[model samples]
Structure formats: structure tokens, C-alpha cells
Target: MRIPVLAAVLATAASLCSAVPANAAAVWEPCDPAPLQCTSVAVPLDHARPHGAQVSLRVSRLPAGRPADRRGTLVLIPSGPGNTGVARPVTLNLPPEVRDVYDVVSFDPRGLGGSTLASCELSLADLGGLNPWPAPDGGISANVATARRVAAACAGNGGDLVRSISSRTEVDDLDRIRAALGERRISYWGISYGAYVGAAYATRYPGRTDRVVLDSLGDPDPDRLARGWLANTAVGAEDRFADFARWAVAQGMAPDAAAARELFLSAAARLDRSPREWVTGNTLREALRGLNTDAGLPRLGQLVRVASGGPLPAPPQPPPAAALQNLAAVATATICNDVAWPRPVEDYRRGVADNRARYPLTAGMPANITPCAFWPYPPHQPIRITDRGPSNVLLVQNLRDQATPYAGALRMREALGRRAVLVSVDAGGHGSYRSSGNACGDAAVTRYLLTGTRPATDVLCR
Candidate 1:
């Protein structure tokens, strides 16, 4: 979801669990911090040769209250082929019901957080500034060029760590951690790209799972996996963007949302013919290209606020190296290893032209060519998404999520067969349950996790 860079790789980094002790592969080390505890476990850096090399993984836990209430451990696997979701347990603001039943456990996967770290020696300019978005006026030449540059920088500088950091490896590493923890099975909550990890883990080791939730899913279609998500982003962006447009018009600008939407489209169209230069250095056309979804519109509103003489949205900050590394990892491993992108520049040009005509809101970003176009290597194995898993899996999703839209989530629902139930929330955001508003949503999920029971059928949360 949203390229899995955030949950996938950002999870690669984390803070010490102050209250826990750092015993080598020991269970429940008590740290000094009152709220949390931490420890380190060792796992093979490469699963293929598990006994060959070891990497230290940091684990944090907030012990369940009352020994009697504690049922098992809840492991949170983050998104992205690279997202570092180590700190999720501390950050989840878990419901008291869940807290009493499970020792919330989490760890940064290898190559992220306290495990080994990898930094691409990319230039500051390449790392920072507004992200390269396709032109709103239907020009993707800049984005195309930028993708090549970024991919080249990563391939040239990314070391062995990049090569080994993959979805399959992370899942194997997770199983090893579960064994080291001495837990017979683990309850898992995987969001966005994490859903794919959870699916993979569940499929590969069906018996090892207790309760699993795949929040936002990436298609298990090995052939399209990441590429499909990237291509379909335009639909998500357009859907969510319309929501914001309605909200903006009803609450502020231009009276009714219907009119505001037209205005928004007109503004973008105007930029196509004559772009207005912004303080951000990119023209409005360029900004529109980058601002594909609701995730990006808040910042763009600031620009509109200024142009309209209202309060300008604060200028956006560029991503630092720490974040870019994760983004690069998701783009590289998934895009490079997934279905090959077309080679001739003309192929991209034609696709972009076709997509832009069909879906203008996202321009061609969802279908745009990436550096994977020039990938130097082929996949080590064909991708596979398995439906075989525990029937307790629950998928909670927003109707409109730019990063991972409803359509993708539906595909996941079908793939899981009766093994999972879908809870569609009437919300608009990237994540669901705890992140999105609605107690009904939070309560339903919490009940399932705490009791191992779920709704009889797919239910809508509104």
C-alpha cells in the first residue's frame, strides 16, 4: 500500500524498549522504562543459509496485565518489502481488552532498525525536495527521468543488504524470532504492504499462526504484486481526492462539493496550458502531478490558500535519506523483481498517454514506467500468493485509501476465500481501525483479536 515504503522499510528503524532487559534471544527481558521493555534476538541474515550469518533483531513488548488474562503474543508485521514496523506495538494505542489478553510484541526486521542498517549514498537533492510527480498537464518526462536517476543511484550504491532484503526473507526471519521467543504460535496484525507479508507468512506456515489480520493488502499475484498496486493508485487517488474536494467545498471554498470538484479540475486543466510557479520551485502542473491522492492534497491546500489569499498550507518538507532508503527498497526489490516494465521509452510514452486519457486524476503515475524498466536481473523465483491460512483472518479497510484502495482490498478478500472476513469502514484514510475514526470498527477488530471470533459475514462499519 502506498508503495510499502513507510510501513515496509521505516519499520527498519526503532527506539530501545527502555523497560526491558537486552538478553540474547531470551523471553520478556525487563527494561528500565515503565511502559515498555526490550531485548535482542539473533536470526540468520539470509534464510537460504540460515546457519551461515546472524543479525541481531530488537524486540519490544508491553506485557499483558494480570497473568490470567494474557492469552498469547501479538506480533505486528509492517508494510513494504522494506517498511520498518518495529515501533508499532508502542504506537498502536491498543484497546484495553486486547492489552489484557496479549503481550503486544514487535521487532524491526533485518536491514531495518536495531538490526543491520543500509544507507544509499544518494545526493541531498535526489533525497529531498518535493517528490517527482507526473505533470498534471499530462507530461511524465520528468518523473520518468527521475525514476531512472534514483534507481541507478540505488543499484550502484545499495550493497548486499539490498539484495537480501526481500519479503520472503523477512517472513522466514519472523518465524525464527517466534521460535526464539519460545511461543508455539503468534497472533499477527499486518497493515498495507504488511498484509502481503502476513499472507506470505500465513501461507508458508499455516500451522504457526494463531490469529492474523491483513489490514490493507497487496495483490498476491506474484506476476503483478507491487506493479499492480502501483498501476492502480490512480483509481485510489481520484476516489479519495473527490472526498476531500467535497469536504473542502462544503466546509470552505466555492460552496457545494459539486462545484468545488469542477473548480479543482478546471484549476488543474488551466495549469496544463499555463502553469503557475510556486515558492516550492515546481509549477502548479508539476505539483498536481505529484499530488495524486488525499495523502498529498493537504499540502496542496496550503498552496491554494496562498493563491486565494487565505492561509497557505505550510511548505512541504522533502524526504531525508532515512525515508528514501525504504522507498528505494520497495521500488527496487518489488518493481525490479516483479513483471518487467517495457523497455523502449516509447512504450512508457504510449502507456502514459493512454492512461492519462483514461484516468486524469492520477495522471499516469499508477501506470508510469519506473527504473524497473532497466532492471539488470530476473526474479529468483516466481511470486505466489496463498489462500491457505487460518479462517480467523480479518481485513479492515477504508472505502477510500489512496495508497491501497478498496478494489485491491476486495481482491485480497477473494484470494483468502472463507479464511477471512471483510469489514468495510466508511472512512477516508490510508489505514483503518485505530488510525481511522469509528469505535464500531475498533471494537469489532478488538473483539476478534481478543476472543478469536469474527463476524459471520462481511459487514460494513459506518
Candidate 2:
């Protein structure tokens, strides 16, 4: 999936919160609308060298409405390696109960939002190269060239700060934030990629976490890391497409679900042979992977109809060039710096061929090689998630998430073992709690968050 970069900048503060010691008093100022406070914490550029060069990370908080009822702090970790959480405190539609009990907090990781920005200064073409979509004929020559070019650009342009972006550094930064807040222990609500971060934090500092929630978790296997997550998308896309096909059939796009699948495959193959306007086989495949949610069904159906000789839809407005570049730089640095990807182009060639034959909807894009394969530096020590933490963690996942998927969530659950309980929702989408509209799942999560209670065993919500 192509992750979008959120570059929202809060209004300038009358006075900035200068960096202070982790235990020093936190100086929060009114940076956004009323009731939202912002601050910056100075963290070492490299966690290992605590006395060396440092960078500041912007943090935001929405104080609890009833301070007397305050339980503790709740940190909302952002999703993408490129996504920022500083604005989430005011932007997310958090439940009133949650807002009343705990102070909601979020932050821009080292290389995002109002923290310290990092860029590769890559051209728009190179930024697009970050996604390894194979050619129409399932060839990898173009992909290989783009991957090498993007990797070289990042290594040359992105400085030490960019190279320092990884889950391990992020966990260190989070502990500093916790210390800055003066909270002996903190609760967490992390989604998507943030789930991995949260898992790593819980594993590293199990004693510091009170109540933890991991939503839409990916595989926590250290050996594969992001590589395994990417490859698993092939299965995720095929599973989610079944839901889309049923929706298309109900919308009268085809006589039945099987016909809808046939129509989509045929249209994609036709576009591969001859492009229609800006629509190509790879573009359509990416669109399907993105539009797997119920809310996205209508737009996806329209795209399919257009591909089947209907009128073309208006093109989407592009994001700012700088935003795109920052996203590509940070995502590439994080994924590549987190683990070692296979370097042989032949590995991707064979994998893509097999993936395309097995899952035509994705067209082998998920298995295709990325800039990570050609990254300049080797990965640092990896964080291994195990069942060594407290039993304070809770996991919520959708049955069919096109990005993280159910299979990966199962792996996470298995890894966590007795330390966590799984709340699986029988649904087709990306997120579950407070997103999929599954009341059962929502109640279980909310109850756990409020009362610190969890299911004795894994529970399925339908």
C-alpha cells in the first residue's frame, strides 16, 4: 500500500518549549486551539550516544476534561513510518469517556511532523520508485533500476538523522517522552505500523507500560521484519477482494460475485495490454489494494466500471512535492534500516513471477523488490517481540485487512503468547476498534481500556 504523508504544521507558538532533561519539568504551551498543549523534547540523534548530537521531537496533548477522574496518560501512536501524531490529539474523534479519564497524547517521530524533518530531495519520479510495482509483463528491469536509483539518492542526500529512523530509536524516544511527562507508567493505543512500535516498547520496557492496545498488528518476526509484511500483502489483497466482488455484484456491476471477479481481472489484463487515459494495470491493482473497505466500495466499483468502457473519473489531486519526498525518504530509511532485505534481483524476479500467477489482483507488486534491497547501510540490532512482557496487552484485528492482514495478526498473537488476548472481528477492512463499527469488538476494547479487563481467551466478534 502507498502510504500518504501528513505534513500538517500547527500554528506557531508565542514561545517554544526548549529541550530539557528527561526528568526536568515539561514546559507545555498553547500551540493549537484551546485545550491542546504542545512541547518539544530533545533526544540524542543516536540513542547509543546519549551525550552526542540531539534532535527535538514535537509532542501534543489534550488534557482530560475531568482532572479529578484522571486515570493516567494515553499515547496515540501514529500509523506510518512517515505519519505524524502531533495533530491526532485534536483531529481524532476520540470517545468522550476516553477523553474524560486520561490525557490524550501523540507526537511526531524523529523525522516527521513538527519534529526534525529529513528529506532525500528526490525527484517525483524517484519518490514514486519507492513502491516496487512490476512492469505490465511482470518484468523487473524497470523496478530494479528505480530501486537502485532511489537507494543511491537517499544515501547521498539523507543525513545521519534520516539513517537514525528505525523502530528501536523510536522506542527510545518514547521512553524519553514518558519520562518528560513524569508518568511512572503509561497506557498505549497504537494502530497499524504503530502496533509494531508499541509491541517493541512493551517488550523492551514492559514494566513502564500499564495498559496496552495493539490494533491491526503486522508480523513481529525479526528475521523478515518489513520484508515479511510486504510479501503477506499478496494474500491480504486476494482475501479483501472477495468482499469487493460481493459488493460489486450487489451494485449490479455483474450478475454474480464470480462474474465481478472475472470482469475485474479481464479489465486489468486489458489495461495491461493497452492503457486507458492515466489508468494502467499497476495503477488499478494499487487502487484495489487501497479501496478494500466498505466505505471505499462505491469509488472502487466506479473505477472498475470505467475500466470496463465507462466514462473516466476525475483524477485525484496530488500531494505537495516536498511532502511526497519526505514520506519516501523516511519510509525508505525506516524499512531499510530496520532489517536486511535480499539483494539479488533474481530473488525478486522469481518471487514476483510466482506471486503474479497466484494473486493476479496485486500483480506481484507486494513481492517485488524495493529500494530497501539496495540500501547503503546495514541494519542495526533488531528488536525481537516475545511473550516476556506483562499480561497487560490487548490486540484487536479485522479478519481481512489489506495492509496488515489477519495472518500477520495471528503471528503477532502467537509471538505474544500468554502476555496478550486477541479480539478478532469478523470483518473486511483495515482497522477494527472504533473503526469497523463492530460493537462487540469496540465494547471489548473500551472495557479493557477503562477497566483494565481482558477476555480470558481469544474472542471472535461477528
Candidate 3:
């Protein structure tokens, strides 16, 4: 059973100081690919037993361009619980002025990238079920079977490291990084799921945080955790699909937005009934969710055109087997270990059926059962985000984000209370700051980071 929000908050507050060990300063060395310095920080595999087995987290840094103006470290938290941040310092398109004042840092969370690795060694078929996309007809029986099998695989082969992965673990590791960097407090910029990490860090180590930005937030409710984030993709998909439809009509893919919607739905339905060798209904749905941005419009339009009986595109290359296994293991363990999923298969069946009728674009996939259902480990105490933190957080969210929709972001804002000010950008995409190209939203966040002044109240950027 899940803990209530207030109790979770109290539990988190009680353990804040004792959660991790004293941070040892990181020994940095020049790594390959100039300008990116790298190091590793060893954190306990389990925080409860700090002296037990250890896991090394790979850390990287791109020093401030103008050291004379350097304010302090600004950590860039990775997006996926599965995504790595070790290269973000070099890869992220950060604004020059911000880069001039802060030494940017990032890391591969445990079970990812260069950190200690763990794998369920899931087969290709089991790996495909990680996202829990429902069958074409909105049935979840196959999803349930895959969930059980994947869960068993992880329990049998993932060992202690995989079982240890969770958002709380990531937060603990981040605090250790702060100590290793020898900074009294650190600024942060976290996108998508990373935003949750930033919020948790701020809550747990409020005094140790400065100028913080949470872009593309997921719901911060402790009771639901990642389960809520997953189910919410149904709503997110619909909100973003409208934008895609409008773009499709503008690009002559259909007569109007309504026709474009029909075109996509019809194509997806036909594919559901008779899937191509590489493309299926779920493939189209996933593509629609991924391609909801302006930069992705052209490809999304082309995909819809082809799916409407035009020539088929070549299949994309598969990811490396090792990488796939690592991602599946980490993502699965993180979500499942964060909170207990409902056990009854009927719970998912009802959810999938309801979502399929209301949100056809997703075909109930977002609500389908996952390996979390059969996960062997019980969850750590969920983090409860509250207004106890400093008023140092600035949240920037797009109006229509497919992955972490605006509606859910409101929950994050509500959870943080007066501790955060929100910048709502009238855009249609997953990320809002630089990724959305919204000068208004970018200006708000940049201003906060550089000057520590958020809007006097919540503001909308049109």
C-alpha cells in the first residue's frame, strides 16, 4: 500500500540529514573529447547501509567560459531515469551568458552510462514491452504476461544494483556530487523526469540549493509517482496530437485539421488490423507522441502521408543490445522501486479500455500494465515535495507537452506552493526553455538563473 502525502513528507523530512555520507571532493582529470573533464563518485548501493557495497557514478563537467564571472556550479540533471547526463555539459544548447557564469556539471545516474551497470538481460521481445504499449485492440493480457516475465528476469539477474535504482537514490547521489564539487550550494536545470529530481533535491536539501529551474515537469504527487506519469501520457498525447494535426493540414497533408486527425486515426486503425513488417499501430502512436514539436513537424507529416498508403520509409536501425538491456533494467527498476503498482490485472484492463475510448491516439497504451506490476522489490518511501524549500525554484512548461503535459505540471506547481513561480509558454512541445524556442519562456528562466529573480507571480508567455 502507498503512504499518504503528509506522512511521506514527514518521513522524508526526518531522514534528510542522515540519507547519505559526507561528500568527498571529486578528483577530476582531463578526459578524451577536449573541454569535458570527468570523474567518478562512489555512493553506497543502498543508503540505509552506507558502509556496504558501493556504486560509482560517472561525473562530467564543462567549466565556466568566464571564470572571472563564475557564480557557482549549475548541475544539469539528465531527463530519463534511464538517460545519461555525463555529456550534457558539452551537448546541451545552453545560452552563452548562463555558461559564462556557472561551471556546468552532469552525471550518469547509477545503472546507466559509465556508472556501475546492471541488466535483466531481457530478450528483444521482453525489451519491447518496457513501454507497456497495449495490443492493437486495446487488450492488455499480452502486456500483463510481458510484465510478469520482465519482472522475473530482473529479479533473477539484475542483482543488487538494479534493485537499488530509484528517484530517491538519484537524489542522494546528486547531493553526494554537490559535496564532491565542494560547493556549498548548487544551481540546477532539470528537464522532464529530471525536473522531479530537482524538486526532490530542493525539498531534501533546501539549504544546499540556489537558483533552480524545473522545465517540462511531471506530477510531483508522492502517492502516484511514476505510475501517474505513465498514465498521464494518454492525456498528453491527445493535447499534442491536436498541434500535429494543425501542422499536417497547413502542410497540405489533409484538407483541414479535422481531416488530418481522421487521416492519422484511420491509418493507425488499418495498421492495427494489418501491421507492416516493421510498422504497427503502436509505432505510429509512439511516433506521433515523439514528433509533436516544430522541429519534428516535417517528419511527422511525411510519416502520416506514407501511412495513408504512400510509399513506406525504411526502418530505423535498432539500438545496441547492451544499451537496450541497460535502459530497460534501469527504467523498469526505477519506476517499480519508487512505488508499488496495483497488482490486479483487472485494474489495467479497466484503465486501458477507458483510455482507448477517450484517447484513441494512444490506444490505451499509456495506461497498460508494466513490469512494475510484478516487480519483486518493495518501494522506498516516496518523496513528498512541499513548500518547505526555499523560494528558489522557477518552473517553465510548454502549453502542450506530449510527454509531460501542462496539466500535470500544474500539480507540480501546486505541490511546491509559494516556493515556485511558473512560466507558462503558449507552445506545443515537450520542453519549454531553450528547446521550445520561446523567447519569452527562455527569458524568464534565464533571468531567474542569472539574477535570482522570478516573476512576482505566475506569468504566461504567449
lDDT against the true structure, each candidate: 0.67, 0.85, 0.84
Give the alpha carbon lDDT tens digit for every residue of 172-275 in model 1: 77787787667888998998878878887887888899988878665667777767877767677675766767667755876876776666665555555554
Q: How many residue pairs clash in model 1?
A: 31
User: In candidate 2, what are the lDDT values of residues 32-79, reduced to their tens digit?
Assistant: 756789988877778899876677788899999889999999999988
Candidate 3 residue-wise lDDT, 1-462, digit = tens? 433322332343344342223476666788755689888777777888887656677888999999999999999999987888888988888999999999999998887777766678788888866777887767788888999999998887777777788999999989888988999999999999999999999999999999999999999889888989988888888888888888787777789878888989988888888777777777788887885468887766656666657667777776887878778888888899999889889998998899889888888887888888888789988899999967889999998899999889999999999999999999998878888888988999999889998999999999
Q: Candidate 3 vs. truth: CA RMSD?
A: 6.4
Off by over 4 Å in 2: 1-17, 33-35
Q: Which runs of model 3 end up more than 4 angstroms from their true locations?
A: 1-22
| Cα displacement (Å) at residue 207, model 1 | 0.9
